[model samples]
Target: MNNLGFFKNPTQITYGMGAANQLREIIDAQGFKNVLIITDGGIVKTGLIDQLTRQLDGIHYAIFDETKPNPTVTNCDDAMLALKQINADVVVAMGGGSSIDVAKAVCLLATNGGSIAGYEGIDTCSNDLLPLVAIPTTAGTASEVTTFTVITDEERQYKLTVGGIRLAPKWALVDPLVTKSLPSHITASTGLDALVHALESYTSKMATPISKTLAREAIRKISSHLRQAVYNGDNMVARDNMLMGSLLAGLAFNNTRLGNCHALSHPVSAIYGVPHGVANSVLIPHVMEFNSLAVPELFSDIAEDMGENLESLTLMDRAVAAVDAVKKLSKDIGIPTTFAEFKVDDSQIDRMAKDAMLSGNIAANPRITTYEDVVALYRKSIGGALVEVV
Candidate 1:
């Protein structure tokens, strides 16, 4: 009870089936004359961009749809160039996490005047970014409401985290209808990413009562609705619940931060080019198992939230059940169960582990970690085995 904590959420979040319809009014209220819509090619192909533009009739805007699956520094540079060329007074992020992250980086660099690499650590940027409006089409990566953004550095092969409260969007329009069209695999991967966010935040060393409350609710919501959202993509109820879960997880982690799973997963995506959600999905269970040793009570609570029947179990058994439940959900949702499935090999583990150690998130991990522990976790994940941490 000696922990002192602080929470701040500046983004005004609106959630519902047609939340995107408010985009024009939100923009108009802010009096942004020129707008840049940052997104990916996939979202454009889905006609979501077209729908957004139609709704934003009479608003002067340009689209930069070159954002890649794992957004790179080059993507941010190109998008910033586009923003300047268009004289965009505001940025509208119109896709998933990649799109939102790209917009945040571009906005930060536009005002701050430097490469993203210069702002890799927490609170490195000294200036406020341009106004940003985020519309998340996926149910995970709640970048819309977060103080952090991840962008890849291709030359160094690392995912650099840029963080500060100034990076949070001014507004978040979370429309569940947009997620109804997500492919089953994308739904599963993103939903599980949100789940990991909640779990990690709940057990983080920085966890506060507020963060834990939101994290536990997020876990419960995701566990109840993620399967239905994955298998029945068009179910609005499931989609809405998943969206809320993701947003809550974002709020929780935005304050408490995450744990080793996120720290390790960032490197995996940066090196192997694995999708962020997929990388997180594959590593979450193993990280949970490794971390359970330090926070058995928290893990036991997670087990109950995830619907594990722990009535007759000891605290340690309940912790094991939590990890098992995560693995089961991931498998049932068709997430790749092993790092090997993503083409990661032992040869790359050492490099990834070293990069993972540099992550600011490692500081918040419930268990204090070492390079050897990270290497071991990487090997166990690749082998699809959950063994006791060495």
Candidate 2:
């Protein structure tokens, strides 16, 4: 309940069928002679990289496809080297969050000149990044529109945030047509990731009126359209809604930050190589349940946004219904089903919980989360079928 009446989104958002093609115009306006395209192997396989590069008729461009799923510190440094080799005057990140995150780090390092480790916490960068263009291929992470980049510090087994307005992309080109080729599982997991972003932001203690409105709409759009997006990747309407939902969620969370769900998920993915979205899916319901104790009315609002039938229910019942709705949604769309398949041991829970406790998101969580609370949540998330737990 932040009463300060503030909102900020510095990225110039461009969305439509051929938004990726708009990159040429953006680069031209910036008068950038050389362009560095940061992406992953998957995008190269999809031929999306080829499609976009073909549009860059006058600009010299090079592709660096070395980005990883987690976007490690090494990956950032590698991308930075690639940027230097090509002397790319502008950077275009043409994939999911991983690609965009790597691009962000590369841009930061190109000008900032230091280890990505030094800028871990927030607003630590002394200089503005190189001109960055984020073209999102997926609706999740919304790295296209965020000022923050999460680079994994593999040595420490932690996900580090390099934040502040300095990292915001100069342009965000969100094209639904580009997401048409996404595999079903990727669509499902990423859609859920967007939902968690909106939900956590909506229920955050730092949430402002503007963020709540954006988050509420994001929740509604994501909840209604996620199944369709997952089941029928050909549906353009569903893709539009999902990508818009992700954009809205990103805007919401960027201002409010996230909550215990994100805080807890970071450690799981950082430690076990679980997909960030899958890790978030496993922890979100339990985190929601924990936070519902503090804000049942807000949960009721979320339940309504999620299309739960709350006609004759008390606030608490509706709050509980929100959790149930999320669980059912995950089950229906084939998410939360992966956590059981991942290798996580009970012996590791304590250490993971300790890592979870270090997250700054804990402070913004709707509930005041403790170290013990994180441990209990991890065990609860693992209770059904998580393997190798003593």
Candidate 3:
């Protein structure tokens, strides 16, 4: 396979400052009724639901707002119950990846019938789901448009990606205005998440020309705008760029897939309750270092995209520059530089490593990795000390 393989994106995308307000008209045009609005509690507090409701005049609806930051299969069960009770014809998700993932799971299981785990891995669902509309509150994860939906199985203690074209949202309403009021820390973590998406996708074994193009642009936009978006939450220009970056990264990773950074980060999140973006931020530099040998040229391209020198430096040196740039951006935006900062224990490393190796994301890493590699990566991340590259 000298030439990169196939690529596809099936979601209907709408972008701009207030695109979410268009949800009702879009849903109506799709001939969907009895909408089930799924979200986390925080988004309800923002009163954006009121704006959503205003547009949904004739649509019958119900709200399920119990989604947590890391959505679990149990969350899907709860939402499914609500869907059945409400007899919802269309599922609308509002808020972060947790809510969106839950919505995706609910939509699938509602029609497909099984535990969310059965759909784990690729294209397991044989049937079409009810139409789903995704309206994202956070600019991270880009879960709104992607075919991937991660739901935790508490019994198994792993974050599983249940992916298929069937899980892709029928409509993706991206409204950057909703992000303008986000607090600084959230802006930092989620912004870093978007960066990780682009980086991982760019270096993924499955990378295609389309995905690479989108990932490169996503990396540049996120690197240039994430800090500004964090420092100045009200700056629409920064918010817009960050929003676009998050979407492009979502599109990129959705096709090309993610890598070891996400693989290692998942266990930290599953075991420690660390936010996904925060975990990615802490592990990205170390994982990049480990994988650099396999894809040095890719990292060199990444450095240039991140506005660093790529011409004179050797590939390894440029790889180091990429890591350095990520660290600097993380620090500037107040992202915790170490996993230990979250109060996770060294004793937990073995379990975390085992779980990381099982993540589907690990398979897409350019470098073939082992459980020992994941453990060392965890140890390196917990140390919080930056590595110096010669």
For candidate 3, what is the TM-score? 0.95
Q: Give the Å error, residue 140, model 2.
A: 0.5
Worst 10 residues of 2 by lDDT: 381-390
User: What is the C-alpha lDDT profile of model 2 across 1-390, one tens digit per residue?
Assistant: 349667889999999988888887887777899999999999899999989989888778899998899889988888888899999888999999999999989899999998898898788988888999999999999998888999899999888888899999989999999999999999998999999999999999889999999999999999999999999999999999999999999999999989999988988888889999999888888899999999999999999999999999999999999999999999999886446688775767877878888888999998998887888888888884332423
lDDT agreement with native, every candidate: 0.91, 0.90, 0.87
Ten-residue stretch with the least lDDT total in model 3: 381-390
Cα RMSD of all models vs. native, in order, equals 2.4, 2.1, 3.4
Candidate 1 achieves a global lDDT of 0.91
Poorly placed runs, candidate 3 (over 4 Å): 384-390
Which residue pairs clash within candidate 1?
none
Clash pairs for candidate 2 = none
Candidate 2 global CA lDDT score: 0.90
Better of 2 and 3 by TM-score: 2
